[model samples]
Target chain A: SQQGEEDPQALSIQEGENATMNCSYKTSINNLQWYRQNSGRGLVHLILIRSNEREKHSGRLRVTLDTSKKSSSLLITASRAADTASYFCATGVANSGGYQKVTFGTGTKLQVIP
Target chain B: EAGVAQSPRYKIIEKRQSVAFWCNPISGHATLYWYQQILGQGPKLLIQFQNNGVVDDSQLPKDRFSAERLKGVDSTLKIQPAKLEDSAVYLCASSPPVNSPNEKLFFGSGTQLSVL
Candidate 1:
C-alpha cells in the first residue's frame, strides 16, 4: 500500500505565483523526501527532511513536516513556467529487516502557465 | 557520474506474453529497487536489493514476476504471462547503502510497457 497521499490532484497557476501541496501518511517514518517529474523524464529528487526536523528549505522550495500529524507540505515560491511538473512525496521507514523502505504518494500535478 | 540506466524505452505486448526489463545502477551503488507505476498512481515498490541480495520483495507478484541482481551491479526483471493490468512503467532506481540515512534514489528513464 502507498504510505503517502498527496492532496490537490491538480493545480494550474500563472507564472510567478506560489504553489503548495500537502501529503499525509499512515505510518511512522524516519524521513520524507520530495521529487519532481517532467512529462517524460525520471523523477528528480528535490529535498529531504528528517523526522527530527520541522522544516527545511532549498532555494525556492520549502518543506515542512509534522510528525505528530503524519503530514508534510511543499511550497514552491515564485513558481516559473519551468516549474510545471508532477511533485511526489516519499516516506522512508526503516523496516524490521534493517533497510530503509521508501513508499511514494499520489502526486500533485502543477501546471505553471507562462 | 552516469545515472542509472534502463533499456527498452517502450514495449507493447499482448496479454500472456513474456517480457523483460534490464537495469544498470550507478557505479558503486549497493542498493537497487524496482517499482511499478500505473497511470495516475504513485510508484509501487516491487523489489529491493542490497549487494546482490534481496532485502525486500513482499510486494512483488511472485507468481508471474521475478528479478535477480547478479554480482550486485546490474539486475533484470522478468514477467511471464503478463496481464493487461500489468501495463505500466517499470522504473529502476539505485541509491547508496540504505543504512545511510536520507539517501535519495537515482532513477532511470523507465521502460513503458503496454500489454494489449
Candidate 2:
C-alpha cells in the first residue's frame, strides 16, 4: 500500500514563479524524501527531511515536515523552465528488526513555462 | 563512482512471453530495490534486497515474477508469461547501509516494457 499522497496532481507556472507541492501520509515515518524526474528519465534525489526536523533547505529547494498533520511540502523558489518535471515524495518507515522500506506518492506534474 | 546500471532501455513483447531485466548497483552498496511504475504513477516497490538476501518481497507477484542478487552486487528480475497489464517501467535503485540517515538512493534510467 502507498503511504503518501501528493496534492495538486498538475501545476503550470511561468518561470521565476514559485512552485509548491504538498504530500500527506497515513503512517508514522522516519523520514520523507523528495525526488524529481524528467520526461522518460531516471529520478534525481532532491531533498530529505527527517521526522525530527521541521524544515530543511538546499539551494532553491525547501522542504517542511509537520509530524502532527502527517504532511510535508516542497517549495521551489524562482522556478525555471528547466524545473519542469514530475515530483514525488517517498516515506521511509522503520519496521521491526531495524529494517526500513520506502513508499512513494503519486507525484505532482509541474510545468514551468518560459 | 559509477551509478546504477540497467540494460535495454526499451522492450516490446507479446503477451505470455518471458522477459528479464538486469541491474548493477553501486560498489559497496548493500541494498538494492526493484520498482514498477505505470504511466502517470509513482514507482511501487516490488522487491528489496539486502546484499544477496531478500529483505522484502511481499508485493512481488511470485507466481510470475522472480529476482535474484547472486553476488550481492548485480541482480536480475524475470517475468514469465507476462501479461498486458505488466507493461510499465522497471526501475532499479540502491542505497547504502541501514544505519546512515543521510542515505540517498541512486536510480537507473529504467527499462520501459510494453507487453501487447
Candidate 3:
C-alpha cells in the first residue's frame, strides 16, 4: 500500500510562475525525498529533507517538511518549460534491520506552458 | 559515475509467456531496487537486494515473479506466465548504502513491457 498522497493531481502553469505540490504521508519517516520523472523516463532524485529539518533548497527548488503534520511541499521557483514533469514524494521508513524502506506516493503531474 | 543500467528498453509478449529484464547497478553500490510502474501511478517496490542478499520481497508476486542478483553486481527479474496486469515499466535503482535516508538513488531508463 502507498503511504503518501499528493494533492492537486494535475497542475498547469505558465513559464516563470512558481509551482507548488503538496504531499502527505501516514507514518513516521526517517526522511522525505522528492523526485521527478519525464515522460517515459525513470525518476531523478531532486531533494531530501530529513525529519529534523524544516526546509531545504537546491537551485530553484525548495522543499519544506512538517513532521508534525506528516506532510511535505515542493516548490519550484520561476518554473520553466523544462520543469514540466511528474513530481513524487517518497517517505523513507527505517526498518529494524537498519535499512530504509522507501514508499512512494501518487505523483502530481505539472505542465509548464511556454 | 555511471548510473544504473537496464536492458531491453522495450518488450512485448503474449499472455502466459515468459519474459526477463536485467539491471546493472553503479560500481560499489551495495543496494539495488526494482520497481513496477503502471500507467498514471507511482512506482511500487517489487524487490530489494543488498549485496546479492534479498533484503525485501514482501511486495513481490512470488508465484509468477523471481529475481536474483549475481555476484552483487548485476540482477535479473523474470516473470513466468505473464498476465495482462503485468504490463508495466520496470525500473532499476541503486544506492550506495543502506540505512541512510540521505543516500540518493540513481535510476535507469527502465524497460517498458507490454503483455498482450
* TM of each candidate vs. truth: 0.96, 0.97, 0.96
lDDT of candidate 3 over A1-106, digit per residue (tens): 7888999899999999999999999989988989999995799999988899999999999999999999999999999999999999999876665567788999
Quote the positional error of residue B69 for candidate 1 in Å.
0.6
Q: Scored by CA lDDT, what does every candidate get?
A: 0.92, 0.92, 0.92
Question: How well does chain B match by TM-score in each candidate?
Answer: 0.96, 0.96, 0.96
What tens-digit string does per-residue lDDT give for candidate 2 at B38-101? 9999999999998899989999999999999998999999999899999999999998754485
Query: What is the C-alpha lDDT profile of model 3 across B14-89, one tens digit per residue?
Result: 9999999999999988889999999999989999998899989999999999999999999999999899999999
**What docking class should model 1 receive?**
medium
Q: How much is the lDDT of residue A62 in candidate 1?
A: 98
lDDT of 1 by residue, A22-109 (tens): 9999989988999998874578999999899999999999999999999999999999999999999999886655567889999999
- The CAPRI class of candidate 2 is medium
After TM-score superposition, the amount by which residue A89's alpha carbon in candidate 3 deviates from its true location, in angstroms, is 0.6
Candidate 1 per-residue lDDT, tens place, B7-107, comes to 98999999999999999999988889999999888899999998899988999999999999999999999999899999999999998755475488899
